[model samples]
Target chain A: MPDTAFADPDAGLSPAELAARHGLGFAGTRPTLGGYARQLWAYRHFIVAYSNARVSASFSLTRLGRLWQVLTPLTNAAVYYLIFGVVLATRHSTPNFIAYLCTGLFIFVFTQTVAQAGVASITGNMGLIRALHFPRACLPIAIALIELQNIGASMLVLTGIVLLTGEPLTWEWLLIFPALALQMIFNTGLGMFLARLGSKMTDLKQVIPFVMRTWMYGSGVFYASSLFAEHLPRWAAVIVEANPMLVYIELIRHAMLENVKLSSTLPHLWLLAVVWALVVFVGGYVYFWRGEQEYGRG
Target chain B: MGVAEVAERPAEAGQRIPTVIVDDVHVVYRVQGPGTPGSGSPVAALSRMLTGKRTPGLREVHAIKGVSFTAYRGEAIGLIGSNGSGKSTILRAIAGLLPIEKGGLYTAGQPSLLGVNAALMNDLSGERNVELGCLAMGMSKADAKKNSPSIIEFSGINERGDFASLPMRTYSSGMAARLRFAIAAAKKHDVLLIDEALATGDARFRKRSEARVRELRAEAGTVFLVSHNNQSIIDTCERAIWLESGEIRGDGPTADVIKEYQQYMNRK
Candidate 1:
């Protein structure tokens, strides 16, 4: 044996003293909140590049390539239109139901995709997480960005469809940008929150689709908010109307269609939209960062 | 050298600053039943989901059971062990990739693991992956762009004609490993962990990588190389740590530790 002489030479010193002397501290220690924010900001370029690459690579294998971004949602709208409009005769009850349905489908899918992708962000990038060290939030943020890009592409198709459905190009249509932007912030927050949650409970992956489906139904994606007020209990009606997704979907529909009537029960939709966006964005971000050191662990 | 000569050696010979201090660190992996979802029926899974009770049977795998070591700057340490002996786990723990279940690890700077397989995307072209890898390692876009040519040249993938332009999935395993090693080696790290990065390289490439590791160490960095190839360990490292079943069997000069490890392996 070589005497093992160097073993624990700093045994006599306190941890703080040892840290000061050797320029070391506990490994995997969570950075300070401000430091964490700075580190994340430094990685902004990587997040953007990663999101762009994944968005482009996502469709590379398909023949339609990037066109699928637009086509997938349109196809979904057509399927819902056939079932809800023709089979269920929902269009007879709601005026300009094609435009209304398309707006709802396009907007709802944007949030849905963001949530789903966010849940998978950490679980999907296990290889990268296990191999390299960076802010784990980057994965979820990148997923949200990918959804944002996809929604941006799909919006072009949405604009054309709204025009085809006889909704005039009024200045109110400009409100769509703010509506989408608010939803983006809301979705990004939800994505960050879910990313941390999904990393801990793999079972969340199985439950998300069902949860999103219920959320879609409650958000009045295929129907009007008035249906809830007319049929459901008073408390249930408030829950449906207060849902942030419904607020966004209603906002977009109002922006796109000049004749679409706003329900009397829905109050202060714009203010609620902004408040929900800010609350979720800040809350989810902090919630996700709190678990930063716990991610990628067995 | 005898034990006395080794003992007389200065503890802080080349560089006095301790780059890595792993103080009685332990890492446990909670492997869910059989590493897959249980064979329960979909109805059972659904019922469990509905009840919000997702309790999978848990088993703890103690990958590193209280390993302690201090690595100083300008030192290259070799970690040698049989399969699943926790060599890679230790490197990962030091890199902060694995959470230490007990004790603590302190480091001077972020430890970079030397393997591109985790950082680079297979669907991306090698050229794009190089740029992305550089950016992921904290290099600015301009620096990544400027360094791409040299990274490609160092990896030697382009020698085969347009390999850099091809998607990484098209490359052979060796080609991929070489490219990954090149990308990681392109930037200087304060602490570098090499987990079998040299195992896939050819003889010439391995020699080049060995020289590069030495160059890195000479620049006042600590390096931990986990490799099964004993010769590479002996050649590239001055000290060797022999671990068996998540415990260090021996730690000393490279030749002495390797000799003890080889004997232990032969007896097995």
Candidate 2:
């Protein structure tokens, strides 16, 4: 009755209005960037609390409480080392291999979980999603934050492994913070991409595991990037060196492994990390935002 | 009771722009199966290429036809409709969860929608979700932390051992729903949407929550409750909107609208 004209009851909010509201999303309808930013900003607290609840909920039913946090990932590292290190003899130094594999696998596992789970995050939580009016991006961001906690626990275990392996401390480990931060940014985008894809094509869920396993082999989790650094072509070596996780792992390896330099591949590493992180994050976020109105329908 | 008498009321006290405005919201739902729509799949397309026409299985559903209403401050509204009459859909779109096809929905403030079952994360503890629900209701973390204990106490589920420690998955459907209502009611939002979240609770808790909701109304806020129980709406709210097939069939004072609705329902 109060001038109901703005409520078109046809085609919803106009494209320009959407773009203005949620600037980073698909900009045709209801284009209101500042509004979307404010909404996302207001919902940040919800994201944090949701993430915290998820992380803490893991221990609520278990007898050991939060101990399962360390135990779950630590045991996983041990199991993988048994198969890949002792049995397959993954061939870094004898003692170094365990620590190396633990760091690489532990870190990589979390990233993969984020990538895989992210695809279905919005769809998976459609119940709460349909009921609440929070930013759609909050779903993936919450998972990313939760993944951070799981990875943090594993990283702590990796630190212990490195120290026990007789690797000395150095400033090189400081790089891990930035490297890990960049990986998080990169995965944030990857998660967005996967979440949008998952909603549109449900079978992508089945395909993700297959893709992840193939990615793991070439990820240098078990093999040394240094081995290939010497003989590989510059572009190929640089591209491989730039795998965000590998660079991040190298930072971890550098901190843990004494006498390891920052690597001559650092330039190539930084360049590709920056570029891929941007493409995945910005591109994925935009793609996800475009599908905002459709998510609840599923 | 007539239009002139109703119009006699000042718009501010209020009746004009209703504190909560839902203007002709139209929601269209499309059914596209897991596979590609229109073309079916690659095989379907290839077969079509080999034969004549491509198969299509996409269907568009108009969940809500054009609907409009306004509820002024201090007015507690009830939406009555059969299953999927677009009752929940309208509420969600009004709360800004679902996008509207046509129409403007302007809330005086954030409207918290607590459906019958709470629909919360089953893996979290009751208290943990309370904290989350409060935060989701737009309360600051410090405020949510401060309010969690009272919310648990109000729901009358605080005595259980697993109340704070047990996973929500371990709780009964009734218990989880109660926790959601208690938590949502903890905050002082300008507008609240309750989609029959009270049926699971005992009578005493219901009475208590109803009183709190009245208090919410007195504080310059509006509440919309969707329910099939005509008696509850007649007993609690001042206004009722009858929705049939996603359109507003009737909207007026509760007793008056309920009278018309009863006669209409009886006719069918």
lDDT of 2 by residue, A1-298 (tens): 2222222222255433432332322111342445655766888899898888777766666789878878988898888888988788775543477777777787788789998889789778878887766678888888888888888888888788888888877777887787678778888888988888898776688889988888777577877767657778888877666666776666666656765544445666666667777888888878887787777774
Candidate 1 per-residue C-alpha lDDT over B1-268 given as tens digits, one digit per residue, 9 for 90 to 100? 2322122224453325678877777899876654346636677668866898754555688999877766777778999999999998898888888888888789888998875456578878999889888878888888899999999988889887999988888998988999889888889999999999999988888888899999998778888999988989889888888777888778778888788888889998
**lDDT on C-alpha atoms for all candidate structures:** 0.83, 0.73
lDDT of 2 by residue, B80-164 (tens): 8777788887877777677677765666556777787456767777777787888776677789889988898888776655476
Prediction 1 TM-score vs. true: 0.94
lDDT (Cα, tens digit) per residue for candidate 1, span A1-298: 2133343556566444665687786778999878988998998888888897797677767888888888887898889989999999898888889888888888899899888889888878878898888888888889888988878877888888889988799898888899989999999999999999988887798889999999998888888767887999898777777789999999988888876766433358998899999999999999998998877675
Q: Please give the range of 10 consecutive residues that has the lowest summed lDDT in model 1 chain B.
A: B1-10
Model 2 regions more than 4 Å off: A1-41, A92-95, A227-238, A259-264, A274-279, A289-293, B1-15, B31-59, B159-172
Q: Evaluated against the true chain A, what TM-score does chain A of model 1 have?
A: 0.93
**CAPRI quality level assigned to candidate 2 from its DockQ score:** acceptable
